[model samples]
Target: MTNTQHEPRLFADEAAIRRVGEGLIARTLPREDWTHEAHLAACAWIVRMRPDIAPERDLPAIIAAYNEAVGGVNDDAQGYHETITQCFIRAVRLHLARAGQADLPTLVNGLLAAPEGQRDWPLGFYSRALLFSVAARRGWVEPDLAPLPTVMEA
Candidate 1:
């Protein structure tokens, strides 16, 4: 679940989103700046601008490398999480499709305003215990609660 201790950070424009994405790609974003909102921002930027890199196929390595660069570990307990990353990527893709031709910042803001952008969104699909399990963290675990929806359901 998202750490609700802090308020969600909103991007002022596309440049803010691009900064998060490019920083993530370059492994240069400050670790503390990689908040949950920042994750969605980066995903939105990638989905909108870097079509050449399929997020589902390529983000795992990128995230893992970034974690290492930021002095974090990609172990079962922390760093890259396969299930969470994949789920958000799917959600971001759906948001992008729904937001055709919109500016990148608007697309991202719309996504952040959606229910799927909530940190606890996956909880609607997977049980808390299962979603937080090491197995789920290391690999994709089929949702144990309600099924994840297709883009058509968005």
Candidate 2:
């Protein structure tokens, strides 16, 4: 009989989480070569991280907003695209903004410190970084934390 006990996830460690977040941010620039799977993964991660945002509840409106902003091209795009992820990220931001929860660092930290089993920590880490990137671009949040040195810089 094969014992199927799962190994405990360690990405919840602050350092590990920071590393994952930094890695995602470092690689997710210039918007080059982002695959459909990656965009879907980001959306999935975001939903998992913030179930209260309820992608089902917000995705339609988000998509509509994205389509409107981009001149309705997104509706004709095939598969999971960067626009999809961008829309979802913006939707989450809008939801939080409506609730007056604009402290992104605090939100990210709280999600990181959540019980490991309750969330996909690695994906959550990536999603938080993605969210930060979007927020920073829109001037919605400031990047005020200690910078995580990337592999290229190290």
Candidate 3:
């Protein structure tokens, strides 16, 4: 796969993202996924930029391998997450702009970086969500925490 810096960005809404988070918690982290190449890449990036986050071994592959053994994987989790992050970042910036809270990116990054050795966390899905949430609370992105509306029978 080529670098994404040259590729166009992808974005998604809150519902799908929450669903992705759930997927991560259920399918990937606890069990694992087969197509973990993407996860592997993401992990490598985190490790490369912040060695403190790097595991002693290939964590993403291990997680993916584990989830794949579960015999079921949701194909859309990564797609949803990517979409949410891109859009969430934009949304947070816009929200801050309206409220006159500038320097949104720096604040959110700092929030994400608060915990030491956060990358060493065994669970990638949880870490990713944790990072996003901390960012949201810190104004790195908007809290789109939209829920899937409940249905009421008439």
Candidate 4:
């Protein structure tokens, strides 16, 4: 009925994907597939559910919460609360650490073949991002644009 944009997503316009990637660089320009809010919700659920094994199973609901939260109770973007992105990253890392894992990145790579050295976004962006998120929130992964602050003192 209505003209849809960014559809058949795998075939999404390269320009659009580039724009999304660039926008992901900074929080300034938002993408059609914003992950932050959903990431937060998922992270929060992880904190609550505290799965001892295979936490990934519960991830979808968390993403949904984030998506739902972002748009508002009714999905109005204004209804979303800006996640304290750093805190979210830190929390996930801490959770993983406390869960007795080696570290977020190593754990992630072990789980998903996500190379720690590459600058390229994952071939499976969302899956990789979700796992990497644990590292990001936990402070295992440090990026300049991140909202987190340094805690370890020299």
Candidate 5:
């Protein structure tokens, strides 16, 4: 992966990372559908970033669940955000439960535990950073975490 001088720090702290995972779950639970690549990529990102949250062995089942949930749509454009978020959330929850953490549901549900309309800027920002970092690490795409477009020269 190419190093950037200004790479965004997504997992700056343990609580912050957990919050992002919870936010992902909160965004995913209500959705009825998902996408395969998006799910796989997201799960992979979470696992890569926080192996303790999700063991590598659980990836196959997580991917399978996402595939089954989507019903074989295979379209890249279908519910990108929801699917990705769900995959990360599911992976973490599955890992916690499988590892006997005893607080899986609480951690998963904590995202919505926050009051309505409360802005989770760090979670939102870091989620995107994690996605870009994972994509670049896996060579799936170029990493572009820039918040704004570059100014063009005449």
Candidate 6:
């Protein structure tokens, strides 16, 4: 749960999402720029542009590497939250599917405008205690508040 409620930094075009995604992959993005909107934008870009990389299967490691590169840690208390990442992946994938074949900027912008794109979106499904727990950070923990959409639903 690296997200905090604040004004979103909207993407102006496909290039903006690309910069976040490419910078994240290369571990070159500045720590302060990895905002909640940026996280969703990067995930959307990865899900749409990079066919070889499966976000659900690979993003955890990618994020962990990026965290370390930015002088962050992936310990139990912080960094690389599995539950939140998986939830966002599902939400982004579903949003992408529903969006059909839109431009990256449109899709990213739309996502930022949706409920799931908000910094506190996961709170709708997870209790703060469970969502921010050490177990949740290290591995996926089932949402205690509500059931998120399943793969079939997505």
Report lDDT (CA) for all predictions: 0.87, 0.36, 0.32, 0.34, 0.36, 0.88
- Backbone Cα, N, C clashes tallied per candidate: 0, 0, 8, 8, 0, 0
Residue 66 error, candidate 1, Å = 0.3
Off by over 4 Å in 4: 1-49, 52-54, 72-121, 124-154
Each model's TM-score?
A: 0.93, 0.26, 0.23, 0.24, 0.28, 0.92
> Per-residue lDDT for 27-130 in model 4, tens only?
33343565432243334334433455233343333333544544535132232222323334444444444445453333332212212112222212224454
How well is each residue in 10-115 modelled by candidate 6, as lDDT tens digits?
A: 8988888999999999999999999888889999999888999999999999999999999999898888999999999988987887788999999999888777
Model 5, residue 140: displacement in angstroms? Answer: 4.7
Per-residue lDDT for 12-118 in model 1, tens only? Answer: 98788999999999999999999988999998888779988889988999999999999999997999999999999888888887778899888888878777787
Task: Kindly list the per-residue Cα lDDT of model 3 for residues 1-154, writing each as its tens digit.
Answer: 1222332222133233333333443454333322222232233233323355333233333344445656644244322233333332233233333334424233333322322112322122234464445343222332233321111210
Candidate 5 C-alpha lDDT tens digits along 61-138: 444454445453323333223323443444444443343443333332332222210122223324566643434333
Task: For candidate 5, report its TM-score.
Answer: 0.28
How should the candidates be ordered by TM-score, best one leading?
Answer: 1, 6, 5, 2, 4, 3
On a 0 to 100 scale, what is the lDDT of residue 146 in model 6?
88
TM-score of candidate 6 to 2 decimals = 0.92
Lowest summed lDDT across 10 adjacent residues in model 1 is found at 1-10
TM for candidate 3 is 0.23
TM-score: the better of candidates 2 and 3: 2
The better-scoring model by TM-score among 3 and 6 is 6
Question: Candidate 6 regions off by >4 Å?
Answer: 1-5, 151-154
